[model samples]
Target chain A: MIRLERRKEPSTFWRVANPFLAVILTMLAGGMMFVALGKDPVTAIRLIFFDPIFSAQFGSYSRPQLLIKSAPLILIAVGLAIGFKANIWNIGAEGQYIMGALFGAGVALAFFPLQGWYIFPLMILAGAFGGFLWAMIPAILKTRFNTNEILVSLLLVYVAERILAAMALGLMRNPDQPGFPGSRDLRRYESAHNAELIAGTGLHWGVVAALVAVIFAYVMMTRHMLGFHVRLAGQAPRAARFAGVAPARLVVICLGIAGALAGLAGMFEVSGPGGQVRIEFAVGYGFTAIIVAFLGRLHPIGIVLAGLLLGLTYIGGELAQMMLGLPSASIQVFQGMLLFFLLALDFQTNYRIRLREEVRR
Target chain B: MILGSINPAVLLAALMVAATPILLAAIGELVVEKSGVLNLGVEGMMIIGAVTGFVIAVNTSSALVGFIGAALGGMVLSLLFALLTQVLMTNHVASGLALTLFGLGLSALIGQGYVGVTPPRTPKLDLGWLSEIPFLGRALFSHDIMVYLTIALVAGVWLFLSHTRAGMILRAVGENHDAAHALGYHVKRVRTLAIMFGGACAGLGGAYLSLIRVPQWTEGMTVGAGWIALALVVFASWRPWRAMAGAYLFGGVVVLQLNLQAAGVRIPVEYLSMSPYLITIMVLAIISSGKARGSLNAPGSLNRPFHASN
Candidate 1:
């Protein structure tokens, strides 16, 4: 029988190879799922994995969408990766995202018809602050009252959805369209609009922010003292304490950063692609970012690549939905499978499977 | 009579029904936590159970078979979690989250064709004389079998954990897996079984929602009931009876808020709708703050991954 033997140190080769292996495993499993669903597995796989980027008909439209879809994922994942490294879980990024959109849009609407450069920057600040404020609830509770941040944050997501619904239906409803439950289109508001920076490339301010965040995170993880503390805290909590690393302070900082970034992602999405604060404004980007962070191995550069890969699936999944009569939920299942495989494969890095004779058992 | 518009007996009965699902899930989770494993995928498992139960009930026209199928469905999904967290020794939090995501997607896929369809009705227990007794009967005795089963389950869990040797062993493993392992107990096996029990309970609770509460299939239903159940376990301080009390308290709040909305009370509908979650946060804070040093009654080895080494 095969037994797992612990490694003295994590294997570098498997650390890199396992993600690829997980992806291949996901593809095979996802193909089987498609077969079970009564679809041609090969065609479904090709459509989801290949046709989005390779097909001449859809490639042009989808290639740009890749950036649009990935920008929020990368931005949110970068911040989340930092917190996850510190063993602080902020499961309420979705709430923070909603609050951020609400805050940013509130500013835009409050200063309606205002055409100043400062308005957009002010909205950006409000967006980050909104997310930061929302996140502080769990952070303060965890720090001061010893409450579990994970459950608190997760519960807040539902609360945030309610607030989002309220805003759409009452507070931020477009007056011109009395019956409609949405805010005025931000795209038409030139000053507040997070317009594409380059034509037909899907490069918006959000994408630029995502890139900068990736670079910043890479630098911090490699060079900064706080990043070292974060890693130390996760690896050895006692050692971290002995080194004078304040758990409460780390909790606050990590949750704060994650909230702000997720909020920023929400703000950018609303101003650009989403265009308005509507009842259906949330698109599960916050939740999906968690997968992106894990898929990236919680590393900055890896997150960028992971985000893009996931973005491709989003585009491809849509294409599949339109052409092959596949349900949109399949993509979600596919992503879940990817994460499952990745986690299951992670066992390889810490242990080696070896066949040994029955010794003492 | 208290509120002029709301009937006290009706409110009480509604509260009991409202609390049953979370109560069942919470009791199950309490056991899982007591065994020192935190399975955060209750939401996923519950939804799987909900859809499976609904589909089966609709097809076979029997609520009993639907409930069983739902439990099996949830258990099967949890086995994947058990495999990952137990055998592979993956991070519990991540694995649980993955299970939820996978469950959600899979349930939605399975339930695609079943949406808008009514499930077979769950029969209410016929209590003849008992159900006819004044206001108390309507408030308590007039529920379906599952509600009584859930209450009995809580009592059974309490009895099992306190008096049974196997339960003692399970608790011992949860409190200190290494120590339990040293004492010749299979910590992993115990936890794996405990996790499956949690899954099965969550499934039954979910089936109650689809087959009895709503009696129809809907995508992404049970919005945050699983999370609320999780909170209930914490509020209960890992005690079975306390979990039931917490569930009833939460259920009362939910029913009261809905009643207020129906009566056109002053509070906005949105705020009223969000009250349960906000109240949960407050309750959590209060419960957590009560203990200064560490978590209140939490299993010492909760959320820790165990790998046997010789």
Candidate 2:
């Protein structure tokens, strides 16, 4: 019987190419899923993948949304990738996003009826700071008390959700829409709105910040000492410690960066598209961003492309939902399938599939 | 006078029912972790179980059949994890996350038709004369079969880990897969068994929710129970009995907060609702200092992949 053997070390070519192969497999599987759901799989697939870029009906409207959706995802994923690369798991970005919205929107509401241009910047700063502080709970707990960051971060999401519900229903509820469980529309205000600088093209400040982050992250990974430390810590904890890569500092930096980016994503989202803070404002972006980061292979540019691809699916999934009568869940299942196959294929990159040897009894 | 209003008897019954699901899930997860696999897919698996149990029980009107269906649903989902992490040697963290994501998606897809439909009530089992003994009766005897099963499961699991040879071998594999492999133990097989067991327990927990607690199918109904199970294991510090203690403590906190809300206690609903998670973190902080983190007994290779390469 023919058997494949694992490489002592995976090749660079295989390592980089694995994600692309995984995407292709996911597409094939996704097409099959669409077909199973009784839709014209080809038309659905085209609408999702090809039509967004070239089809006349949607290309104009869809193209701008690409950047709009990708901005927050890229921002959040980039920060998460940094922590993952450093072996620090921050599973509470959803909570950070909620907290960021709470803090940023709180600022705007406090300064309501006053149109100072500087207030927007202040809110942005506070948003980032708020997220950073929430992340610190787990980071500090991990560094000081040896608490599990995974559990700590994960549990905080529930806490944050409760806080969001409270604010929406109680303190931050719009006085005008009495009894409604939602916050004031920050976007309606001149000082708080995060509108596109380039109008219909969807080029907003958040997108610019994301691109800047990608470039800076690329440089950091390729050249900087801190980036080197992050990679080394994940690859070899012993070597990292010996090389004087302080675990405490890395934890704080990774958590802080991730929190800030999630915060920015939250702020931009609330001010731009969502327009108001509500109990369900997050819509699982934080969790979905994890998939984006992995699909990008944790590279900054890769994440941009991955983010756009995922964003297209989001738009396509909604379209399919409306047009084909496909349940909204099919989209989530498709995304889950992508992660499933992506993780399954990661094995081929590292180890070749081989049968075990029989031992003499 | 205050005692007259508290209704300690009813409160005990509610607490027992509330704790059963978490206890079942946390105990299963504790075993899986003790075998050195951190399965974070319990919530997803439990949700699957909840829907599956509801469907089966509603159709068949047999609570036993519902639980059986739940265990089957959970085990099947867990087999995916077993295949990926145990057989393919994929990263446990990523695979566990994928399991949950897939479970969530699949459950939501399958359960869309069942929403707004209530399942048949789980039949409560009476312990004959034992249930007539005042406070003790309500506290321990007047519950569904699953609650007793859950408590018995805790004791059984505790004994299995502390006494049995198979349990010892499983622990050995978790502690050092290579050593276990060298000693002719099928480390993968052992771990796979642990994963299935965990999945079944998670399934029972899920079934308890839909078939007993909520009595209806709802999308994302288990909410964050899986995460709570994960935390409860940590709180228990990986011990089976400690898992029981941790689950009861969490359940009490949840029930108390709900009671406070019902009583119109002046606290904000948000603060009251947030109390459980916040209290868990505080408890984590108190017990987490320096030494007691994750039950000082967590296996060295808890989340590592084992490659049986020559």
Interface RMSD of each: 0.9, 1.4
Candidate 2 colliding pairs, count: 0
lDDT of 1 at B20: 91
Interface RMSD of 1: 0.9
lDDT of 1 by residue, B85-190 (tens): 9999899999988988888888889999998887777889999999899999999989999999999999999999999999999999999999999999999999
Runs with alpha carbons beyond 4 Å of true place in candidate 2: A1-5, A354-361, B1-4, B291-294
Q: lDDT per residue, candidate 2, A1-361, as tens digits?
A: 3344667797667667877887788889888887776788888877777777687887788788888888888988999999999889997898898888888888888999799989889889988988898899999998888788888888898899888888888888999999687988877898998888997888887898888888988898879999999999999999999999999999999999999889888888887887887988878778878888888988999899888888888877776776677787777777777877878777777777655453222
Q: Write the per-residue lDDT of candidate 1 for residues A36-139, one digit (tens) a residue.
A: 98899999989888887888988888888999999999999999999999999988888999999999999999999979999989988999898899999999
Task: For each of the candidates, give the backbone clash count.
Answer: 0, 0
The TM-score of candidate 1's chain A against the true chain A comes to: 0.98
Clashing pairs in model 1, backbone N/Cα/C closer than 3 A? none
- Please give the distance, in angstroms, between residue B216's alpha carbon in candidate 1 and its true position after superposition: 1.7
Q: Which portions of model 1 miss their true places by more than 4 Å?
A: A358-361, B290-294
- Residue B264's C-alpha lDDT in candidate 2? 77
| Docking outcome class, model 1 | high
